[model samples]
Target: MAVLTSWVWLLAGCLSAAVAEDSNVSALYPPLWEESPEQISDYRLEDGKHIMDPWVITDRMGMYRILLKQTAPYFASYAPENEQNILWGLPLQFGWQYTTGRLADPTGMTDCGYEAGDTLCVSVDSWWADVNYYLSVLPFLAAVDSGILGIPSDQISILPPLKDQMMFCYTVSGCQSAFPEAMGRWSAFFQYMQSPSSDFDGLLEYLWAAHTSSLEYPTRAFVDRYAYYSDQEANFEKNWAIAVDYIAATRLPTTLSRVHSFQNGLPPRVLVDTDIAPYIADFTPLQNKVLVLLNVLGNIHHFTGSLFLTAWESAMSTKAARKLFLISFEKFLETSS
Candidate 1:
């Protein structure tokens, strides 16, 4: 039920990097996260005019401005050798985002254990959500294009999240260790689905060169990969149908429509923005937001089924058929390490 607006971002330091930041791309990051004008006077002039040195960022009410004004960006600048970005008690809180009407307001879903603003986790059934994942990846890709990730455009896949190949079910920690069993199975399944061949070498090159990225820096990889797969208008619907049938007949529940709204859900993929100017050339804000929202919901449905399969603890045998519930979730490590 949440909407994702544009997510591109840039990385310039405090007041010092103003010229370098502005001279580069304007489309990659949100206004608050990018370089900006020095709005106030830094000195007095002999000609009766005041000299101005504007602030570098625009998030006057958000963390960028407020935090930088009070302190420097890096902990290295701290007077005490061991200090971090904590004012009062919050240590580097990203600007406010609460699930209720306001950014930090409580949702009162403690009974359901659903906290607003805490990332929503859903288990999806038979649905296609690459579109959603692509939306999440765009911002990171933008950063990469902007030269922030320090990799040649061709070498970006050497980046963390995509380097080791596998079927990643969700963003729990780093994908492989987080859901080893599920990723193991999904990786095998995707291989079976694609059967990488000489004919599909284009896809392989795209994946190795572009589709993959480090979760630590997945933004650029996502933008290119998403555009590649979805834009090609590949046979995604047919493949998803096959996934639905496999789940329905041999897996849990009867069909892919059985979605889980609570307890588990799809998560957004994170990325960095290094390259963004060219993308802004083709940017269409209204359409992009709508696409991201649709992807988020669809991913939720698909992930729920995967969670149920991984969470299936025991075998079932009964005169009236069988059922498996997460009877003792404590048996498994519930939190992502």
Candidate 2:
């Protein structure tokens, strides 16, 4: 079965908080002003940047094949003139680092809430790390292919014809596809599966007019090239570096100053790839206690909001103070081993 990692923010395209629209933070750290609080259309962050525009895609099979365009940034554009070798915009600093020097990884860091195991390094920051997660939705796949890709509960074989029709130059004119034909061909494969009776055709007609696939950095190459400075690997280094130093010096969990981060770790580390067994033990007891308490409260129905908040806070404690995640990792089976 295809995995559909649906997120609350996917549908929360509108923003309710005025704070998001007016926040001076656009200078950039985290996007506290998420679309959830407001309609993304009202505050299209990528408006003229063209590169970040949300509507620049080509539909293939049941997927949106995104291509670069002249209006988009030179780095991500597929246009021959704007074609960047890397997927996303590569920063100049990492380019210099790759050519001019090699920075040594911290050989040792043993601290609660942080661990750099073997050659692989790991870091722990507060919710600041959540940005590492991507924003891919099945809806994206479905819209590109007339909602056929939205079927996550069943096994569907790859349709060869759809793939064949997908490869080509991307433009509003040529990029527009005959998703109706594709949808009709797929309808017979599943009884429960329903294709729109030309309603989706009209929707596709509308959707096909504007391309919408520039919201994310699509490839590892893009991340590697553009994120060299703050790549997850490097951020892991930074967070772990701070964590280790803080723990080693304080011999305890403490709120770390952000300034101490990432000096040695150029690219942030990727914990998603970490072996859970090696580091799961580092999760602190405080987090476990909170999660356990939340579980106790979850038995009741009314104080539910508190239960959710407790769970959320407990999960967010990836800082130097929680081993509650040992259970979390085991529950999620995120352990590398």
Candidate 3:
């Protein structure tokens, strides 16, 4: 069975309340966002080929960092300091998953992602890591196909995770064959990236198309994986999945800084039954409410399908309006329920 992972995210790629900065926040980014070598010189050479292993969080993140560094020139005309590089969203989201322990083995039967075991290990047992593979490897291989990596496709080899090794494609041709739609969409993004006519909005459109496709395809495959997670976590995953469609429709910038900022409004770790809005002192009231609303929306039988996008776009088109709507929504839920 070619299964999937139950990755979760909420309020990403959209407007959200302000984030509370952590005291040890710098400790949260992936292992080497700042120091990871951007060039090919650092990769292990095997039989004259650069070996890439993404099963571990650090190495997987390194690929995105390297891609961002390599693609910086293409985006310089749009924004400064690689801020506009569409690839930034990939690593930033992955970093959050790492800090929040989403990349760890959720089952508790294994220490795959624990500091006491292999801290960098991205467990196959983790739904977040599994879904992330599509986001990571597909875009990565597409980058190589688009010639953004500046390396021959055959010159590099990607090592698979410890388990579910057969589920993913390792080479450019393999990925293209297995996931043509996502690979093609991502290839278009990179191609447009190098085009002289490329603009920020256009790049974002392409990026989001590919981003949502990557997410949507694996969701059905991983429906069975939800059994391993807590109800709160599973609900959050479904809610996050639903929310991304609306965000993609809006074509949000999805830059590194913007995503990093928006993600702070989300819960940093797996949600437990005890964690509830206005009751959890660690998170702001707004964050708590946002979390609560996501669960409500995800769990509500009446809120099925993609119908909300029409209303969401018409009524909450502006950031202030969306924020106000979400803030007011909790009250509505209170009154109605």
Q: Which candidate leads the pack in TM-score?
A: 3
Candidate 2 residue runs with Cα over 4 Å from true position = 1-52, 55-217, 223-228, 231-337
Q: Model 1: per-residue lDDT, tens digit, 214-324?
A: 221332222333332222122222222222222222122210011111101111111113213123223343223323433333354366754432322112222122222
Candidate 3 lDDT tens digits, 230-294: 88788777787776766675566666555666676678777776776657787765567667766
Q: Residue 330 of model 2: what lDDT?
A: 35
Candidate 3 regions exceeding 4 Å error are: 1-14, 17-31, 299-302, 310-337
**Cα-lDDT of candidate 3:** 0.72
Position 322, candidate 3: lDDT: 46
How well is each residue in 150-226 modelled by candidate 2, as lDDT tens digits? 32211222121112123221222222242323222222212122333423223222222211121112222123322
Least accurate 10 contiguous residues by lDDT in model 2 = 10-19
TM-scores of the models, in the order given: 0.18, 0.19, 0.83
> Candidate 1: which stretches are off by over 4 Å?
1-24, 35-175, 180-337
lDDT of 1 at 81: 24
TM-score of 2: 0.19
Instruction: Rank the candidate models, highest TM-score first.
Output: 3, 2, 1
Model 2, residue 334: distance off in Å is 16
